[model samples]
Target: MSAFEVTQPEIHTRPIAQTELWELVMEAADYRCHCTGGLCGSQHSKTGLRCPAVHDQTHRKGKGLVRLVAAPADLGLSDLAAVELPVDQLQAWCPSCYTAARNRAREADANARRIADGPEGTLF
Candidate 1:
């Protein structure tokens, strides 16, 4: 075994414009989670104003580190569409918040569709 190890970055560096957008979003959020909407299944008000999680730091769960992402505020948007959105429409989200929001949105959509279908195998 070698005496030292260098980590190799598997992800490619973002483009300049994308990088700038990400930086602005992160800066605007103060490098913390922007999940004050209460849609992520977390009562952010109880925890404090906005999520206290910061980027590049270990999560409270002692799991992986938190790396915030610049994504569209509308959780229903697809990943492709989210990336095309303008900086003003983007919000900085911690991984857990983003995952929870996306899951809730998807579940809501599925429920709506089920209701619209008017029950299983029923003809009105």
Candidate 2:
């Protein structure tokens, strides 16, 4: 194996551009979530859930929690670049999509590990 034993990536503080963050949030929301669509408090009262985008997914058998990892280090706090606006809003993802993403990541990591281990056959 290579000297780097597939350790988790170090937590680097990367500065996020406000425009980029906004785009990410909007893209995740599709301008349809409670945070963007102006339906925050009421929707949850009726059904104990937030975000219309996710609500719609619930009918289709989805967990509906936002998969957007804008500020994981912030402990469930959305990243806010300015006092007035969140840098990245939450997202809506189906459980299957989330699982697929996770599986893809795992496969990629396994491929990386195999590469690190080098050729299977002995050269000498």
Candidate 3:
């Protein structure tokens, strides 16, 4: 193997909803991304191409797209059972918006941790 070959990290799997939950969430969002009307606007890419992605979970499944997911705290619940979430909380996001949201959350968490840890080589 070449020294430049990079190993991909293992994928973390999450419990996803069955068809019924997927349908409910999609309906609540009117079959479009919740971000569609906000400043994010139109669910279109910077190149002006409309994002063709449907409402989907933030995770992947064995090379397939995951359509919906219950809250992370409820992932251990049965997929066949209905997940009850507040109408305001059950948002449908296109892949681009979803990815941007996840990345922002990740960065926020990292920043919080760094702040809590204090700067390197500094002491109170």
Candidate 4:
């Protein structure tokens, strides 16, 4: 019998001050929308949709949100405030890229599993 193994994704770590954290998120985005990569794609604010806007991260219409895994919980933001907020070092992405990356990751995991299992030998 073959043993089954589970694989976990890698974890990234970083630190930032509360206010500095917002600055980092905004800086990475360059005041542009992650989805359309625009300075004012439909999500633009009256001030032209500033980057690093915490609300943008949670808009959920397939724009501006950048999810981070295993993030630290000491940024001093309320749960709602943290929901859409990106990490200081994390870059924003459109929904398409996010989905594609996830798919590629799944395929890579499958390929790794096949290689680990190896091929059976055939003899006449």
Among the numbered candidates, top lDDT falls to 1
Q: Model 1 off-target regions past 4 Å?
A: 1-17, 119-124
**Descending-lDDT candidate ranking:** 1, 3, 4, 2
Taking the tens digit of each residue's C-alpha lDDT, what string does model 1 give over 1-124? 4769777774423335678889888889888889985779887776675787888788978877788888888988878888679889999898889999889998998888879977678774
Q: Positional deviation of 118 in candidate 4, in angstroms?
A: 3.1
Clashing pairs in 2: none
lDDT (Cα, tens digit) per residue for candidate 3, span 32-78: 55543222334345434433444443332244564433232222233
Better of 1 and 4 by lDDT: 1
The lDDT of each candidate is 0.81, 0.41, 0.48, 0.44
Among the numbered candidates, top TM-score falls to 1
**Lowest lDDT 10-mer window, candidate 1?**
9-18
Each candidate's root-mean-square deviation in Å? 7.5, 20.8, 15.5, 20.3
Q: After superposition, how far is residue 113 of candidate 4 from its true place, in Å?
A: 1.8
lDDT at position 90, candidate 2: 36
Which prediction has more favorable TM-score, 1 or 4? 1
Clashes of each: 0, 0, 0, 1
- Per-residue accuracy of model 2 over 1-124 as CA lDDT, tens digit each: 7997787864322226554664465456553343222122233444445434332224333454333323221222323532344554334333343344445555667787878798778773
TM-score of 3: 0.44
